[model samples]
Target: MAHILLADDDKATRDLVKRALESDGHKVDLTQDGAEALDRLIAAPEGIDVLVSDVHMPGLDGIDLARRAIETSPRLKLLLMSGFAEELDRAQALKSPNLNVIIKPFTLEQIRSAVRTLIA
Candidate 1:
């Protein structure tokens, strides 16, 4: 099982995603905002293996948050999810070569598969 840091502004979405990941035996540290996520990531870089975040959010946003996290921990895997296609594309264009992405309204299997593929 992996330790994942989940950063999303929506409380309901964050809760649901956290539960889904936990059900699959992954440990999830849920954060409601990007700044807090960055702080947590910096505080425990080795404790987090993957970061699953929503692209469009208040404060730091996912792209910046992911970039900062990567700077802090180069090995951290990033998986982005967003409802906005344009924003997602823009973020992807600037993302690290190995970063992964999933669109919003995805299935549990999709999330699980993405995580597995990265970890593998």
Candidate 2:
């Protein structure tokens, strides 16, 4: 199972994602914002395999988080989620390999599949 770092301000979304990933037997670490997420990533002695974040957050939005995270861990797989078209567009503009985006209002199955594919 992969160690996953998930960052999202919305509690429901965070919990939902955590639950979905956990069901797949992945060990998921949750963060409310990108800053905390970055901190966790840096502090992690055992590296994280995947990062799933919300594009819109209180501080250190997903795009910037993705940029920094990728720099810090180049092999890190990333998935940015957003309901806003503009935010998704912003994520699309980032120049990072192994980066993927998903629109919000997705099913648990979809998210699970996305992560499965991401780590595959």
Candidate 3:
């Protein structure tokens, strides 16, 4: 199983994702925002195998977080999520080979599959 760092500002969304991923046998670390996620990544660069973050977090949006995380851990796999088309477009424009975006309102299976595929 992969170790995943899951970040989202919404408590409900974050909890749902964490439970879903954990049920799928992945070890998930939950964070309320990108800033905390970044701190965790910095503190233990080798600890996480994947980052699944919401695109519009308060402190450090997912795109910026991914950029910074990649700087510290270049091989880090990213799965960014958002409901906004603009944010999704921004993620797409990043042109990161290791990055993937998931539109919100997605099912648990969809997210589980995405994480599995990204880490695979």
Candidate 4:
């Protein structure tokens, strides 16, 4: 019942995540990079409940995207995913009740559960 923006460079990951959230009845917007995701969020900051993004991308990475997203929409919840532990560390500065991180190779159930918890 929420609107979600998912950003990832990997097409397969994006599709999988989109399907996962969509099946849960969320309206999912797909973006190939953090820059695109930022643009979408900026263009329409309203109604986006959660942002599930990959921590590393081409132009704008998820960490920076999260920062900008919060500025654009402070109420937005964030789920930043990454395979690299270093990137996860970079997210430390963004620690908040609204922000969470998932290690890569996550299960669909885990992601769904995380999102549910985030938006709860």
How much lDDT does each candidate structure score?
Answer: 0.88, 0.92, 0.92, 0.92
The sequence of per-residue lDDT tens digits that candidate 4 reaches over residues 2-118 is: 899999999999999999888889999999999999999988899688999999898898999999999999999999999999999999788767999999999999889889999
TM-score head-to-head 1 vs 4, winner: 4
* Candidate 1 lDDT tens digits, 14-118: 988888888889999999889999999989999999999998899899989988888999989989889889878877885585588889888888888888888
RMSD, candidate 3, Å? 0.8
Taking the tens digit of each residue's C-alpha lDDT, what string does model 3 give over 76-117?
Answer: 899999999999998888788889999999999999999888
lDDT of 2 by residue, 1-120 (tens): 889999999999999999999999999999999999999988873489999999999879999999888888888999999999899888878767788888989999999999998989
Q: Indicate the worst ten consecutive residues by lDDT in candidate 4.
A: 88-97
Task: Name the 10 consecutive residues with the lowest summed lDDT in model 3.
Answer: 89-98
Candidate 4, position 94, lDDT: 85
| C-alpha-based local distance difference test score of model 2 | 0.92
Measured over all alpha carbons after superposition, the RMSD of each candidate to the real structure, in angstroms, is 1.1, 1.2, 0.8, 0.8
Clashes of 1: 0
Note the residue pairs that clash in candidate 3: none
RMSD, candidate 4, Å: 0.8
